[model samples]
Target: MERDSTAGGAEDLLLEDTVSKLRAGSLHKHELAEAMEVEQEGLVEHQPLEQDDLNFEKWKPKPKPKRTLHEKIDDLKTYLWNAETKEFMGRSGKSWSLILLFYSALYIFLAAMFAGCMCCLMWSISPYAPTYNDRVMPPGMTMFPHVDVAHGFDVAFNASDRSSWRKYAKALEAHLKSYDDGVQDRRNINCEGNTYFMQDDLEESAERKACQFKRSWLGECSGMKDKDFGYSKGKPCILVKMNRILGYLPGQGTPVHVTCGVKKGSTEGLGEVQFFPENIFNLRYYPYYGKLRHVNYSSPLVAVHFPSVPYDTQLHIQCKLNGRGIINDSPTDRFLGSVSFTLQVGA
Candidate 1:
């Protein structure tokens, strides 16, 4: 019985210790709740202050400071030339040098290629004669005082006007300047009148000698005798010459002659016409070798003189070349065969 009573007493002590631990735990939980509530109240109070600061900052934003003109120019200058970065015009010095070098080399190569092509083309061409003469075949005839009118040759002037006729006379004077007797005697040889002066052999200077054609052969129509070329006297002289072709033999052995008359269907009458020296182109000027070979070469001239053309009349005149191997009537090319012109004399 005594042992049973001691056991009951130990059980009561254990229950009391358990109850005390439960009470201590409840007090600690109550203190933790109070500390959490105090911290939440402090956070709630700071939140409104933070929101007011944000609203205040949004209401009035700080303005950007305005730069003066001098400051802006200074900024632009710094952008154009940045000394710290060693850059000019938005590029570093080394980068700009490389770009300039690349373009310079590219342009130099292109210029060299162009110069090389031109040199090769020039080397293939003959200096003396043209490479192709197909378009210039059969040759063409031209006249001095060549006044162009509506795609055709026309000579119209007042006979009494010295200013008008003086230009024609001056043109003739310039044309015949190379054919002067003194110039011809020095540069050319006097060949037979009706025979060809064939120069098969080249001279010591690697050139062929040309025949002399003195201005004196033109007689009264020559500017040497009459400075006016008969224009002031109402008698105008027109000089005719044949175009030169390389290695071309015109008229064969026969003499080429010029015949001028009123064009067909022309109402106006052509008065008396005269040819200086003769109406013929002498045979000595044939078989032209090129400009380089035929040095000092002068094409022979035929002066046609209108001794008595009617005053105040426009006469359509056609001068034709008549000889063997010379095509004088080409349908397609009017200038290729012969030359036609309109003549108007004013009082």
Candidate 2:
């Protein structure tokens, strides 16, 4: 009986403890709710009551109203002309003068620096000799009577097309005009062929021997024989001349000559090519002095004739300078010692 009564009392004590713990948790929640409500009320009172109250508080500012056109014009006028500050374009007269003086001094200093740099560069350069001759080594060769020079020395024309052929003829005439007998007389010397005309120092005459490359050497292609230089007749004339460098000498007596042929494996339309001046750039004309030394210097020319070119077909022609000291083929240089040109004759 005593054990049963003790068990009942323990169970009642456990139930009372649980009920007290639940009541305490409810009181904590109610206190937290009151604290949160008090904090919210305080925040609300601190907020801006009137618009004037916003002067001291941080908040999103109201958007400004759009300005009228007249108001904007008035603002612009005020910016341009402020009589009180005695200013124009937002800058006072004194400020503008100071800025102008600063820029003027800066520009003057920069100009002086540029002039000094140019003077130093010129001092490094030699007037008598070239800075680098790698590109100009063995010199360059040029083919005259160039037509349709869009890329390198390409000539493309329709034979039946009169305008196209006429353009080519005119180009040839203009090129030949420079090689006329009267022009050559003024600038060239009656050089002795088959020998190198070498001049070590500037002579009293101040001239070097310029080879007389007569138009007669060109035969039918010469402007004298055919005014169109063979372009009208579908057979075109090409004149090749080497660019002269100061004190450059080719192999003696061997002579640099042009070797022209249709590209290998090409169509057999290109036939019986003829070269004038015997396909030779004679050694006598070489070792040219500059324009300053030789005032009337003329370069020697070799004329090439395409006797029969198939109509309506393109002919790939290779014209190479064959001689010692001349680079025949270079992958890096496209137009160093030789020149390649395309000829498309259409009917």
Candidate 3:
């Protein structure tokens, strides 16, 4: 019976130890559960705070640094000629060279086209003849010793002053120098005065023959006999010439004649008018070819002499070309077929 009691006591002690170990295990599990719940709560709160910080950082703008003048100059220099990229004005050297070559070729093409057009224009036109002659039709008339005034040329001079008339005489002398007999005979032919000398053929030098107008034909007005041209004696000589028209003929049947008279309401009369070599332009000089064809052609001249112009008085004189085709009455063209001048002589 004593042995059975001892075994039962040992069993009771072993059962108590097992129960204590189970209770301790239960407490550890409960504490671990509570710690896990607190940790989950802390993670949720930290996640929202971290998200707010991320949003603030995303919306905030970065501040720009202020650059000094030297820094700005360096930036400009880099833009103009970048040492790092080897670029000039935002373009590489090779790129600029290609662009330059393209523009150069385009300009060269344009210049060549322009030159070709000019060459074609030059080839199309002749150098000897004019392309247009509309403005030069019918021709015009002019005079030498052409002193201009309000109404017309004023051939006024004091007879007592040699200087006053000397220039007029000199002008006449110079005008007649080309008409010298020796000079005319050398370069021109004495063609028939009443008919036209039409030359369709060109000479060996490719020129048409010109007519001779002798200086002696001017007679007293010629500078050979009277060097002063009567200016010192209060009488003056005036020369009249008609402008040449290319391929134009004047005076169909009758020869073109010049007639000088005192204009109406003249204060003084034009006294004792005389014309040298007659008042007509001989038909031989008509139908003038161009300057290239008629190289030595000299236009015929008619010299008018005023022997007794009233002294100390002004006289209005008009010289008109009387011809069928001439338009002398046109008020619009005062210088077409006529030339008028004022003459005043002082004793």
Candidate 4:
């Protein structure tokens, strides 16, 4: 009985201790709740969503607009063309400039093509310019104006008898004697323009030789020499000589091709346009034209035939030492040395 009573009292004490601890824990939790409530007194969330509102202290920026290809290209173009020149000129101002640019590009492209073609064209195929190994070309240079000089002479002789040869020689002798185109006189009288007439100077003198002719061979200089300018019963060769370079006045026809044979024999049967080339200066600075930069080797012959040609070939060149210093290579030294050669009929 005493033991049962003691057990009951112990159980009561244990229950009281448990109640006290629960009370202490409840009080701590209440203090925490109160602190939280105090902190939220002035702040309020206005969200009306059913779910708990999320913290939105930071905001995301919107994405940049996408650019189109055309728009991007337009912007680039605008930036480029906004220069004062383009803007002031506008479409009209640009028209001429654009045309000039286009033509320039076209001309450059064509020049490249022409240069490429130069190596291939039979007439332009000169083994001399690139392959020659001479400081100055030898004499007797006008032998082969074109390979046709021989063939043309052949055709001429075959067209007539030895009398044609006699006539040609007599005409040649007389031509050599005259001061200037005296043989052209009788030539123009009888063989006037129907077939081929001697130019006015050719018509003016029976005693002078302005040009030469052979009946049969042109490509290979034959009959008169191993080679002739052309082979024709009615062939012609003209000569024009000067002590110095009289500045080139525009001519009427045919492109003048220059060669490098200064020696006398170099121009045997071919037309010898003798000139002691004392190169002239001040031509470049005149500002009227770019520069008098080429040798018009065949102008006299062409002028003899037709009289209204203009602008000779403008050779492209740059200054460089010709084995001598620039001082040694002055305008006087810039001789268009023995620059003469033959070409087939009309070339």
Candidate 5:
């Protein structure tokens, strides 16, 4: 059966306006039936479009400002400067804060040089450096300081000690004994039947004898150099330092040997041998600290007795090494103290 939808709806109550229009004969029946078969929901309202609103001008956006090269450079500089400041200031110092760097460096360098010099002064370079090369000791016996072979240095083995003189005395004695053994053979020497060798009594004394300076230390540990044949004005001296420790015999005319111990030491850049005085009282045939020096131990000493003692008379002593020639006429050195003794008379 074909049913009409508006047939059961009340007029002016719930019926659609289309139905009302059809009942009033204003709507056509075929249109109403067609409308009933289709959707009869609420109207789909749409706003009317304005003519101006529909107008579409060409779409365009404003141009942005571009940064200049100089601006970029400025920004980079600021960033770098800030970074550097933060790094350096954190340490409470600046990268260029080493203000006295040059002076500090110089101070360290000089200090090192001074230390090196001191070390050299205290040590030797070699043990057999020829000290008497080209130059010979004077005719008499005398002393020549430890010589540096490469440079022809004739000076003592850096004798810088003045406190204990005798501590090195035994070594001096041993060195002399060795030198004697090396230079001359004491083998097969005939000291025939009960032949007792006697020392010169002139060298005998009841008490120990020592050499001491009157008021000053006798040029102790003097740093001198090898000069003309003798100690003119420029030469090194190995002045003995004496005190109670040294065998100082407080009498007149005591025979004493000042054995200078050649203390051995080494250093860098030097090629020389150094020795101390094993020669006492011209122990060798040379001068000790004066000119035209000669060694005495290997030479002869002529002794004479004087009836009259020279008051505060100064006597100079020197010597030569075992294997060298020297002179006794070196006139530069003089006694370092007051005269308290004289040579014994020889028969």
Candidate 6:
């Protein structure tokens, strides 16, 4: 009962002091109203704000502290010397050795597999004959005095231009270099000009008689007779050689000849064309067996001459090779057994 009286006395003194403050106008009317509102709402009394609580800068996000070089080194050292592992750099010696060994083994296995595949491929392929004769079926034909071999039989030049005409002459001379007598003697023999020379075995002489394709047979265009190859005289000569395939024969006693003429509308621009050595590729040089068997074998050549051509005009000429088993009319094979060239002359 005495403790209750003491508490009542203290509460009374507090009420008396508050009322005195309100009467003296020391306490604001809003404060008195707030105190009454708090008592009526039964809300807890608000504590006074601390200096730190009032400061707004303390509420902002702190920046991350930058690590110094020594701190970074220490962290690296700690990571390297962890409880479970110790490493020279980033990995343990054992880990590095294992990685190297795995890579070496993988490389060795890959190399062996590649070598085995190459061996299998080589075993299936033949050194003598091609596996697929896609381009070799009809035999590809080649022609000299070609402006560009990549462009396929398209030859054009100014008649008065020495440098332009000399290119063709140089090409012809280089092509005929393999026909030296000493070189021909090693692989070729005297063949009967009338018949096809066929050899079966390597017993007597493995070489078939290659026809003597003398440079003089080209007449005035032959380098032996005319060194300029008839280029400067407005008469440019062209040589054609058929690509040889092993065991290919044009047939028995069927002669292959080349025929050249101006195209339909180009006759006015170009005059008559003449062919040398009777305009034929004889059967004696048939069935060319690579460089190993017939080292000095020469393909029969025909030189076509454009005797006269008018100045400042382009002439289209078509040269057709007439023979058995040779394709002359294939649209895809423009230069197969026949070719077309445009000639231009200027003063």
Worst lDDT 10-window in candidate 2: 200-209
Ranking of predictions according to TM-score = 1, 2, 3, 6, 5, 4
TM-score of 1: 0.72
Off-target runs (Cα >4 Å) in candidate 1 are 1-72, 147-152, 193-195, 200-205, 264-268
Q: Which runs of model 3 end up more than 4 angstroms from their true locations?
A: 1-92, 95-99, 147-152, 201-205, 266-268
User: How high is the lDDT of residue 130 in model 3?
Assistant: 62
Q: Backbone clashes in each candidate structure, one number apiece?
A: 0, 1, 0, 49, 70, 0
- My TM-score estimates for the predictions, one after another, are 0.72, 0.71, 0.71, 0.15, 0.18, 0.69
Which 10-residue span in candidate 6 carries the lowest summed lDDT?
A: 203-212
lDDT of 2 by residue, 1-347 (tens): 99999999999999999999999999999999999999999999888678776566556687899999999999999999998888999999999999999999999999999999999999998655567765465867788767545677877777667788786678767777767888887777676758777776665346555677666667877879787677767888888878887768775458887888776555466787888868877877767667766666667778888869877777777788878788868889767778878887776
- Tens digits of per-residue lDDT for model 3, 201-315: 6552378888899899998898787888888888889999888887777888568999988876653477688999999998888778778778888989999999988898878
lDDT of each: 0.85, 0.78, 0.84, 0.33, 0.30, 0.73
Give lDDT for model 1. 0.85
Question: Ranking under lDDT, best-scoring first?
Answer: 1, 3, 2, 6, 4, 5
Extract clashing residue pairs from model 2: 159-346
In Å, residue 300's CA in model 3 sits off its true spot by 0.9
Q: Which of candidates 3 and 4 reaches a greater TM-score?
A: 3
> Could you give candidate 6's per-residue lDDT for residues 210-257 as a string of tens digits?
556666656766688777787777767888777777767764458878
Compute the lDDT for candidate 2.
0.78
Could you tell which candidate, 1 or 5, scores higher by TM-score? 1
Off by over 4 Å in 5: 1-99, 117-135, 141-301, 305-347
